[model samples]
Target chain A: MWRCLLLLCFATSAAAGKPDPQRQRELRSLLKNDCGACHGLTRKGGLGPPLLPEALAGKSDAELLRTIQEGRPGTAMPPWKPFVDADETLWLIEELLRKQPVSMEHGG
Target chain B: MIEINKSIDKSVPLLLLLLYLLGNVCLAELRGSGDLGVVIERERGSVLIIETSKRSILARVEKLGDLSHASVVFSRDQRYAYVFGRDGGLSKIDLLQDKLVRRVVQAGNSIGGAISQDGRFIAVANYQPGGVKIFTSDTLELVADIPAVYGDDKRSRVVGLVDAPGRQFVYSLFDAGEIWLLDMRDPSRIEIQKFSDIGRQPYDALLTPDGRYYLAGLFGESGLALLDLWHPEEGVKRILPEYGKDDEKLPVYKMPHMEGWSVTGNLAFVPAVGLHQVLVIDMLQWRLVKSIPVAGQPVFVMARPDGRQIWVNFAFPDNQQVQVIDVEDLSVSRTLQPGKGVLHMEFTPRGEEVWISVRDDNQILVYDTRSFQEMARLPAVSPSGIFFTSRAAKTGL
Candidate 1:
């Protein structure tokens, strides 16, 4: 069920491709600075659950997307729907799924 | 040729002794570390050793790993700071020399740590493996490990690890809704007093100024779990349990920090969970006296050293602004816009000045606590958590 939906979303997103470069940078910043506040900088988990590739290995795209949009109730995680749209949240999930989350960490 | 070589070797030792003594005399500058502090450069995995009096960054000590959620507690001597990193890296920095004295990766992931009353043992609260590990303050060697085992094969992440008087460590178990008191008077013999069913999801906590009460802010509910260290036998009491229960709760973007100088005199100011107000509690009765509205969700609602002013920094969407509350009338005295991403605020030892960390601007702004004027500005790289050496003398910093 989730597997089939994951395939469809991945196929569609692969064609749609990643967000623009500027939005990509903004999303990455939000991931490290905002999301990283609870989730560890390395995405190993702190106040929130870990977002490492290994942690989210089996989850489907829809489940992950809903969690980002609506957030998990009874936890510190908040819904980012006001700040980000569905498309941007999907790109963030991909960014976390990509190789080396810390590599994208930009410093001043 | 052999006799000449032997003579040169003997002379080398004598020459090195002279250079060693001379190097110590010239390089060792006699300066007190009482006014010094450190600002965490989160993105760069580094920290800046800052001097409060001059408002200058003395040195940038780099290569500290995973400082995304880093916290620091000073040694009793104020010469060293034990920084607990998100990656579970415990770094001891030498303030005088402005360098990383030693770095040790003790756990998989940790939030913060505390030093024992004697300053001999450093206890770290771990999140990943879920436990508390105590180490020798001087050598950073493992002395004791107590896992937060709440249920069958279930480990809870430890938060609010604070050292109280009588050489005891009080901390909260986040997942289990429990608080444990670890007695470390004798490092060999371990004793723990567990307070079960205290509250739900204690995100963070702080020990009071007099080191009497340990308050744990509840994220699962709208109350704070208070444990009086002087009378632990009485059990934990829930204070302000129903605050904002009927009110609308906005989605909390960032967790409110329960640790800091949030208490002063007869009153304590706490950030309401997911509400734009600061809950004022009377320390005498442990009751809610007033609820002062604020600009946004408060993160660090800290009081000045003199107890005259309360400075607050907000979380997420309104993170750019900081509001000051005049303690006399209990009102928002002034609001200052210190650029974007105002991460943290720290008062100097004397309360004459306060340092604010603006992350997006990459600048630390110092303001006069009395006049509310920007005194000085210094450059930093995405700074957070400005901790001063004065905390070394206080309990539960």
Candidate 2:
């Protein structure tokens, strides 16, 4: 049931529609916990980078999608398409771009 | 009489030219091998082909979904080229016809292959499935499948495959630190011998020329383990270290499982991927002999057939080139800048040219052996392993 909802949220994000706000928050929490370990919050710069407004501000949607899906050239970032679905990637990018910075010490 | 003498002189020059033409014809025999090096781009869903000799686009076979790796084996006559895509796409290219003759879909994404001693069969290690699939070299037909007895469906990966002298072939499964010995004397039936538990991630394995023992590099252990093929039960474990294990003079150095061994079987050259040195191990003594300092992350070390020099690919972030190491003196000889993101590379059949598969720009860069100069650049993109065929050397690929 949770997997289906996650899939639905991803589908809506990819189709360029407003996803469920409650589900979006849940998805945001997941990305913050899982992806932030390496890529960091907002994709700025950590072991990877902050995936947020300032870093991804002027980039094209295609560029963001390609980098996220196919992987950036000459880095450890592998092709995420096989691991993460397209719609979920869209939601993850959205979450990355919009999330506010949290304290680095304890918790978000 | 004067007119007759002038005519005779004119006929003399003509007769000499005729003789030269006849000699040329006799010397130009039809039976000669011409190896046409082919560069294949290993990308998702599509693979591009480029003929390196003339810098021309050959073919772009598409719809092979998410092709991660490929191995090409040319027929002895060089008439046909067999391409095995890791995503399970097997294609047969007729060099003379210049088109894909047949394709068999449904092999999984794979990393390495072991061609038969007689070059009749190729056993491919499928990464996702954690198994090795065997196919007939001539027909591209599925012959056998051997699944990983120890690998997990979600986490495990297979990297390298080496054919043992007998009916058995050794496979190194990734992350598991286990080498599985598989027997393929009969394609319809297969036997499995699980041995060599060295450490995590055995990168590549190869048999010595004498075919007595097998040497595999352990990624997690930062060493190469020499195992006796004759006694799998005994399991001989010998580690070749980057620095001398007990030497107090040199600081302890541990390479991150990306080293390569030379073809001579006497030395194992470990390219310290994160360090600034190439570790040399004398295989006979099974000890670390010397550490030659290098510039960047030397990921791959490929030895030439002559066994005099070792070609090391220093794949730093965006810094694309390969380094040549003189094995005799253990020194850095020269470095050849191949081009952007040289993900994988393979040498030509005669070792005359080195073909580099640069994934970023999606092209294979060629270099001349004798001059050590960029001979030409053929546009073949996103390629992992380069392949070649000699079938129509008269009309290059």
- Which one is best on lDDT? 1
Model 1: DockQ vs. true structure: 0.49
Q: Kindly report which residue stretches of model 2 are placed more than 4 angstroms away from their true locations once superposed.
A: A1-108, B1-34, B44-63, B151-155, B209-213, B230-236, B241-261, B361-363, B390-397
Best by DockQ: 1
Deviation of model 2 at A82, angstroms:
25
Each candidate's TM vs. the true structure? 0.92, 0.64
Quote the positional error of residue B251 for candidate 1 in Å. Answer: 1.1
Two-chain DockQ for each candidate model: 0.49, 0.04
Compared with the true structure, all predictions reach lDDT values of 0.89, 0.59
Residue-level lDDT for B107 in candidate 1: 90
**What lDDT tens digits, residue by residue, belong to model 2 across residues B1-397?**
9999999999998999999999998986543224454455443444455554565565665544334435665665766666666445667776554567787764445554656655677677665566777878777677886677563454355665766666567767666777777777775677777764676667666565555567776545556666777788777475754433343221111112231235455776766434566777776777777888775656566666556777776543424777788888889899776666565656665567777776556666777766787766665544666655532221101
